[model samples]
Target: MPERVVPGRPDGLITLGAADALWVDLTAGSAVPTAFGAFTRSPARARAGYVLLGGRAVTTVRASGGRWSVSVGEVRRAAAELNAVGTDPQDLVRIGPFHGAPWQEADEETVLCWRRRIAGGLWEPGRPQRAARRDLDRPYHLAGIDWRQMLVERTRDGTQRTWWLPRAVVRLLDAAEHAEAQWLQASQTHQAGAAVTGPPSHPRRAARDAGGRQATDPEGPAASLRPYNGELKGQLYSVLSRKPGTSRGVAGWACAVCRTAPAAVLDHCHEHGYVRAPVCQSCNTLERPDHLYSNDIRVANRYTRLFHTDTDDWLRHWHRCPGCRARTTLPLPHLAAWTAHTACRSLRPTHRAPRGRTPCGVLRVSWTGSQNTPRSCLLTVTVDCCPSGEHRLLAQVPYREAVERFRVWLAETAPAVAAAAGPDRLDGLPTEPRPVVADTSGEGLALF
Candidate 1:
């Protein structure tokens, strides 16, 4: 047997920025699956939200069967309105399911449905069957000639059904329908543009930037023009045109890396060669070609490119935190301050160590790198003895490697140092969870 392919799951109400909806059989007093086509579409999942029905807010309830539930009495009056309608023989352009007798003398209670358009016109009704009163009272799912505007029920028994929506029900759901229509239209337009332009190009750097040359200086002004490279030009145009918060070509947006700086340049990951986000000139230079840096941006194992306009607010408000390893905390306001604070913390003995050990001979720890520099090319750890004031040079390594070396030294060598320092000194390493602020400016406090 051949494997069956399922269509991708549809976007939810949250992604669409609209109120969630659920299908309900008002007469039966229960909810039904909102989407059909178990074979054509992915498995359905229950969503939570309220919908306006019969002039009342009907809260959505997830049932044990992975469906929704509702009260019959709450929608009984509206059910009558939907059920009372019957087949109108006088109407020339009939579409969707209809109830009542197709001709005089036929049982009025029988259910009759018109087949979809065939040979440019709707076909005659199929064999009339005596339907349960509850089936007749089920509300019509709203639909459009060109776009699917309402719920479509596809049964596993190889049957499809949709009904005609009354004017009152349509009026109640006007906002949701309009929003869905706009989303569909935009998606179609995007697909058409992709067809014309060919597949989008992946992010790559200029030959000079990729060949081990240092990035442009941080103080220099960011490049305002779109990327000149042919491969990047098409993708840049598409991203700028679709990215939200960007109006008049990047004027309305701020850089994602540095919240305070204007978004003057597009930043892409050096390792993966894909656009990450818009960033300021300084941040762009700070990102290394191999992603080796002591900054917060390097913490994420993977970075996401903003593709949806609706996700602009989320990107602006959330960021990955290097201190706590939390991916959604607010960004550190001062990168330099956070780096210095983290370096100091790495030198201290962790609280996991046993208490009552003698103080370590290592009194003061200092590094050689300047705080203002974007990259710490090398880190030099030196310790100064207290009374003798003798300075001793220790290991020198890359900044990130130095941090780990300090952790290992403190764990293994610090206890031996306490014995060498003799019993005269009583000061012990501080083990409190409270972080020492790097400066008086009160920056980088969110890490704690």
Candidate 2:
């Protein structure tokens, strides 16, 4: 006896008698086994047989006898192994107790009936068949499997039947079905010349049809020129061909006020619509129409008076008249008298007047620097005195030179005023005439 290896079960081997068995390697398509040679040569009695190796039916042959009949126990063992390896059930041959009948000889109806009976585990040799629901009799429910798209087909002889899908195989059948239906619908619509609802197929053509030209006109004085006719198109082309600076450039190349940032926009007076000059974006924003009435700008003007004219500058420096509260510009000599009057009026009535004379005049000297440039200063002198008038003087100079000139003026003026008033009149003054120098700490008017 010789042993042959089973196809699926590595531990199982089949024993064959020398005369009854012949080696037939199915994968290589060898000739019919010697055991089935007689049947293959004679067509009249030839019946299709199957060889089960390791429980999986591997090939068909023409043969007869107990030599090919696999026992129930062997069949069960083979099935268990096949199941463990996930073999397809269609690959298996029918298990039978019939006396050496070939599976190919069975009629279609009889084979189908047997298959139905065996598929539901209703057939067990020598054991009573149990009454159980057949697959057709009960609703088919397979875990993770959808049956709606399953397909079935039969072979040419009709003895063997197979399905396109396995019972346990799962797939996204619904999504595939929907996509197929959508494709069919789209094809039908296209054939019928109906418009499809989706993104445009030719975006450039669609944009042209939807008036894209009007939205993309280049901003310029001649931007209004449109190609309504050939003549207009020619004119527009000529205008566009000119050099860049010919029409768009401004005469002045820097902001009028700051004079730092490049002049990039043509600013115009909002009220009159007259071109002011080329100015940077920041300077133009400050002069917007809304800022004319803004309280913040008003407050800012109260301090610097830059928004208004030079007359506001004069009034701010004078501090107004004490008796009439009128805004006036006076010479530097009249400032002492104006200050004295204002200070005398401001004194509280409840407090007794100074026992001796008190000086009521005040003089202030300050300087402003140009924020855009270093070492630049605008020096201003303001004097406030009683019963005469107020005066202010302004000069532009270098920062360090301004400070030096102010220090020199303070040293000279303080003694001259005191000497002119004399010791007798000093008692009527608030204090001896003293010049005050404005300090950088922003504490206004400190007397020196």
Candidate 3:
């Protein structure tokens, strides 16, 4: 006789089997019993060595003569786990422990035979002969079980036991069993209802047939026309009927802006309360002016430029500076002028004129001849800090080196000066000076 390997605990075994072969044995006494009212209940023990049924441990027996009983606590836990895996435990039929010798020869044939018998309950007689084999292969393949790793252990007591199966294999088997049970129940229901059938009638169709009417049949368009109070509908019908070429069936008119989408709304001036033209819903909602002046063509043109075209054109033409590559909201010409003017003004004050008076910063750049020539082109940047102050010259440098010096000052020197002065001192600094274009055309130079 093979060694009788009693699985886990012998006392309270809950055997789950199919076709007289034990498949899963849940140990009912491994966990301590909790007292409820007069009865004591034992929870299902989750042993790590065995496969998990729906993520809960499934203890199996290798030997015969173990007490087979299903406890309420064990059933509940199994049911909960099964429900989590989308299988209803109510659909499965619980079978008892059947007498069988322990598996002594652990080979492919033995393991395949055990699996076939256990899963054979899901196979119907009408199925192909190879259907059981396919079903057995499905779970094994899906679970990724390694047959090479499976070992048969023999204990000192001469009992033989099979190795632990994978958890995925157990879940797949449980799911297949559930599906088979549901199919059987559905087949039974169909057979029982076979005597009472013609084609079934829908409740809605039956109701409609009985009353000989539909909700929209008598007054769909006519009911909708009533809300317009007859006058507006009459006016629309008369106008559309008169202009047959313009009305063009139900296909809506084109949008004025994009000229592609069908116009689905009446665009109108909110101030004048008059319909302008039919426009697409998108154009009507998005392109409407925030506030409109009188409905003149000039006003309309101005609105188009200010609201739509000008913004897009400005953004398209904008580019970062070549020297500093800094982004500014100001236009290119304005930014170039501002940059050169700001750099010249940051020079140290040479002479103090008066206290409590706004100081004027000037940048005089000579464009023509040498650095010390008398007949060179003079470009003066007079930054007036006060409203009532006369222009005074501050700093002078050659035009060729002014921009380079400004760029260097901006990159290396300005940050340290601004940081040391802090935000409060900087705030007291004069506002940005506007560029003053002088009459330098006399010297053959244009102030940009």
Candidate 4:
């Protein structure tokens, strides 16, 4: 038996014309396996996100006892619609799981959907039934049609969905050539010269930047006119709080490494490549080393190049891992980041982070990496001299971290440092959550 390989789809949506949509029914069934008794809820687990547009929908079909049955009138009508619908980048046509509902009734329900044509591809909701040659559940394509719009309307309002085909009046997809009537409208209106919607307005660059390198655009597709960092950094880039302040005037934590007031650096271990608490500048750079540098433009570039592609051919061409022959299931941005910078997050440095030099407390952050390896970074700290002592950590410049986890860690540990620091003039510090022994071992930490 030949080994079957499932490819990840990256873009586009498939829709059927309401008036004629039998062929669409057959095509839709090939993608949806559960109708054939093969069930799937989330495509993300079995397939790649790149296979489906973030906001697009595809038809689903099912089979029973090794065969699918549909009305001859329905098939003829769908075949006519598949050929007649007019398509364009701006205007799209959709046809469906007959009427959009997935339930197997004596009569079947189908959904036809459409979306923007930023990407192209074919996708299926299920798998082929056994080795049967005439299996109607096998996947096919909407050759010669670049569908653009798909809407979902329930039949008489039920949990089950039925599809409505738009643009059923004309033929859009022909033998092997795509004819997008709506897109032609857009071309006519916008001309060959125009900026894609949104910021970073500039003419598209076909290749690398001035120094012969990849250019990054933080905003999106059309936002690459100016210089932008792909590697995230700085205040705007930071997800972790980088400083300490007494908001309501009560302190609970002692700097884990410094043994002084205000445990602002929550779980300040460099092994994890981030700071949980608000960090003092010196401690963050020299004492603790848990920051990542990123430029959104780079991420955006990768996303545009490889995510949500709709065509199988495109998937095969672009999603291969340069690292090895292994087919990649990760998004293009993630793959690019990994390829470009080893894409390691929550990393530890070769140099040791200072534990604490003076009367101080200590905190550790532990988390897993993509490889599932336990990562441990360090942050050495020093304390401020005075009755209201302050312990601080430092490390090299630049920081990067996950936002939510860092926030929770800080909320948990900041109080300890605040109580240790004692009373101060800074306002709005919390007076609650009495100080308790700080847990040096990080908890509730995982790589998302």
Model 4: lDDT of residue 341: 22
Give the per-residue lDDT of model 4 (tens digit) for 1-448: 2111123311111112221132333344221111211112212111110111111111221112322122233234334434443333222222223322212211111111221111112222353111112423343222212222232233322332323223221122111111121222223444444445433312221114433222221121112112212111111202343333331111123222223222222332221232233321112222211111221112222222222231222232222211111212222222323222222222322222376333223212222222212132111212223223343322211112322232233234343322222223213322331222222221111110
- List the candidate 4 regions with Cα displacement exceeding 4 Å: 1-25, 34-448
After superposing candidate 3, which stretches have Cα over 4 Å from the reference?
1-341, 346-357, 361-378, 383-391, 413-448
Greater-lDDT candidate between 2 and 4: 2
**Clash count of each predicted structure:** 0, 20, 3, 142
TM-score versus the correct structure, for each prediction: 0.18, 0.15, 0.16, 0.15
CA error at residue 39 for candidate 3, angstroms: 77
What 10-residue stretch in candidate 4 is worst by lDDT? 44-53
TM-score of 4: 0.15
Candidate 1: tens digits of C-alpha lDDT, residues 301-402: 111121122223223222221111121111222222223223433452322226654222342323334322316635444443423344344344454554
- lDDT of the candidates, in the order given: 0.29, 0.27, 0.28, 0.23
Model 2 misplacement above 4 A: 1-252, 288-448
Candidate 3 lDDT (Cα, 0 to 1): 0.28
